[model samples]
Target: MKNKSIFLLVLTLFVIALAACSASGAESSSSESNASESNANSNSNEVIDIVWYPNESGNDMKASRDEIGAIITEVTGKEVEHHLTTDYAIAIETLINNNADLAFMGAVGYVEAKNGNDAIEPVVVPSGASGTLDDAIYHSWLAVDVDKQDDFKVDGEFSLDTLVDKRMSFVSNSSTSGFVVPTSTIIDYFADSSDYGDLTPEDLMEGGSLFSQVLFGNSHQGSAVNLINGNADVAAFCDNCVENYVEAADGEENTVGTVYRVKEGAAEPFNNVIGEEFILISVTPVLNAPIAANLEVLGEEDFKKIQDALASDATANNEEVFVPEDSDASGLFYKTDQERFIPVEDAWFNPIRELSN
Candidate 1:
């Protein structure tokens, strides 16, 4: 009877001790779960998505994507992610249709996207541009051989009538500043009872854009290369790209520059044909395809988060400059029509756009 009682007492103590241990464990687990939930709620601010990494020129797309992701994640305390696109044009189209969040399209590509969709906004231009223009931001220019600069008396301005039948080189049909804008301007130049005949890219490709012998270098550099190599007598190039030749040469005399200029304004005559500089085309956004967010897809707060992320020093500073500029592009880029990049309208670009279509 004594042993039985002792056994019952011992069992009772064991049960109480086990219950206490279980209760402590349950409290500890509850505290940990509550802490995790709090942290997750804090991070649920906003999220951003980009169509593709701007992997132009064979850059490491993932590294840039990550930098942007980190910036948004930190600033807005939102989870950020990256998306890739195999087709750049498709990406723009997707943005227009509100299928994607934001995209980076080229000069001409932007116009098409804008015409189709007006909900997007323009935010930035290049950093190196001084935003100085003699006429339009981007102008159509004509260049003769520096050796032939003496033939045109051009101090600051030039006319298209100068090269009626000379061999000319232009960038491929796909380019905005290179092929499309310049050709459209030339076509307009011929429309008003001009000495120069109307020309087509087909003609130019077949030796015909208001001239004879079309050498498709397929790139701005190719046009310059053809000019220097004596493959073509004349060349049409973007004003901005012309300096690259001089830059690449580092003043050692490469085939790139016979002249370095900021703008080639409206059509005018070169009075001094002797020792005159060749004309260069400066281009502006006629239809700037903005980095637009699908308002339908990305909520208002989320869209702003993406923009902030791109400009954030945390992101911008870390984001690799595929073509690094000497100065920062942060201030240079803005969403305006005239100040930084104003709405040039789709009609302004129709001349080029029509040809492209």
Candidate 2:
């Protein structure tokens, strides 16, 4: 009987040990699961990195970029890293490839990027002086040196009919105001002519077809410099893009016959061309440029924040993003009583897209 008691007691102890072991295993599993959940929460809370790509036009506006960047950081709580580019294609590609979170580009560039990747969306665009999209535009000018302006005039008025076989300098084939708008105007105007009925934008890209020679300045400032330096008989650029460096020398501002001369103390490309004047032969209004974002990279929530921040009244009056005419601050936007950034829809650019078709 004593031997039986000893065996039963030993069995009882074994059972206790088995229960303890099972509880320990369960506790370990619970601890590991909690740890994994903690790690996931930490990862989710981590800040996302944002990259901004700017068109070549903004390459020289560092102070303006910093102010804009600060606003973005304030809204997102993430610092923005700028990727400066010298070509429109580079900025467009960067945004389409998801390598950049944001981009500042014209309607053409934004449309192209959206075509490459539908994930791109327009965040905001600077409004006209009246704070309305109806006049939210910039001018595309077909200009010639002051000395050659008379050669482009007919019957005492400026005309594009004399542009045939003239040497031309275009900012970039991808440029909206510099190339797309101006080229579309040329194609439309000459489509009714018997000899040039088959003319296409491609035909004007090379020297032998219509122009004596074709040169791409790669930037608005560069295109204006090309004309002033005698590299091309005529050139295409935007009014506002060169506003900081040029002022009206003859006629009215933005008028087709107006002549603009480089400011005396203008920056780089314009420094040597100072005092040189270019007369506008053609002036066409184009849609305002937009600040575009990659929806996939920014996500809907974060993108909304950025879009709202940019369109806020505070940003409009910041003076740094939209510099006042009298202010010495250099900025991407020019300030007026009602000028501000406004949210835009993708369908708004359909008109620009139609020009290509």
Candidate 3:
């Protein structure tokens, strides 16, 4: 009887011990889950800094920047800081090094950043007027002074054949529209020529057989100024970058042979070239730029919040962000009935990557 009693006691102790162990395990698991939540909360509350490419760093873009920043701030409950840069490389490096939480950049710059740091990812891109990727594009132009427009014609048709031996200005080597697309077009156009069949982008980077001189404008506005100032015979720039400062002077918009002139009260880089006209000799459509982020810095939860906020209807209908044609608002985005921001994956930019290949 004493032995039976002892056995019962031992069994009771074993049950108690097992219950204690299970409780401890549950506590540990709960503690770990809480810690994870805390970390995510801390990250979400952290301030986000956005770096801008030189093209959009001017004071004229402040309203647009503030509008976009406001949207992010509203959704994340975190303050936002805008880091305006005067150089593309600075903005790119800032994001790659994690000094900036996000960046607004072209496809080439985004590709460069992603190549530099795998953590960088595309968050969203502004869609075309159709509210889809089908028409989400901007134009890259090879332009010259209107007075010299006729000089580029061959057999009553405008052509790129006269570009050889001319002085050229490009926004920057890292620019997608300003350099990559234009150069690719040039290389492809001259690939079958007997004298230049083996032409490459590098050959056109500097002055030599291909050009009389090559100049780096560093910005789209700067490139347009170069052509207007007579510093270059032909210059490369983008339509959206200079659209706010220039007005259509002649021909159809986005069409080759169209002429654009700087406005009367244009801001400083273009101020000196006011009333000057440049005609497009070549125009090629390119994918729209993207607002990219550093996933490591933003953390997954916060990044999702930001991504969803940007793709929401509130952002699309915001006048300050997607300015209307009749509105005098100086902003980055132009609104169409169906225009909006859309999420995109890394593969969306493969075409830009293919250029280098």
Regions of candidate 1 where Cα sits further than 4 Å from its true position: 1-101, 116-123, 126-141, 151-158, 172-174, 194-206, 215-219, 241-301, 311-357
Query: Per-residue lDDT tens digits of candidate 2, residues 118-221?
Result: 99998888888987665677888999988887899899998778988899999878888889888888877777789876878898888877788999888888
- Provide the lDDT at 225 for model 2: 89
**lDDT of every model, 2 decimals:** 0.43, 0.73, 0.79
Please give the distance, in angstroms, between residue 257's alpha carbon in candidate 2 and its true position after superposition. 0.6
Which pairs of residues have clashing backbones in candidate 3? none
The alpha-carbon deviation from the true structure for residue 246 of candidate 2, after best TM-score superposition, in angstroms, is: 0.5
Q: After superposition, how far is residue 158 of candidate 2 from its true place, in Å?
A: 1.2
State how far residue 301 of model 2 sits from its true place (Å). Answer: 1.3
**Candidate 3, residues 1-357: lDDT per residue as tens digits?**
222212323333333221100000000000111111122232344677788888898888888888788777776777777777778888888889777778899989999999999999988888879887767788889999999888899997788899989999999889999998888888777777898778778888899858889998999989989999999999999999998899889989999888898988888788777898989988888778989999888778767777887787777887878899777666798986778888777877766777755
* RMSD to the hidden true structure, all candidates: 25.2, 23.3, 19.0
Q: What ranking emerges by TM-score with the best candidate at the front?
A: 3, 2, 1
Q: Cα lDDT for residue 29, model 2?
A: 7
**What's the C-alpha lDDT at position 89 in model 3?**
86
Global CA lDDT computed for model 1: 0.43
lDDT at position 277, candidate 2? 84
Q: Model 3, which residues run further than 4 Å from truth? A: 1-45
Error of 3 at 125 (Å): 0.4
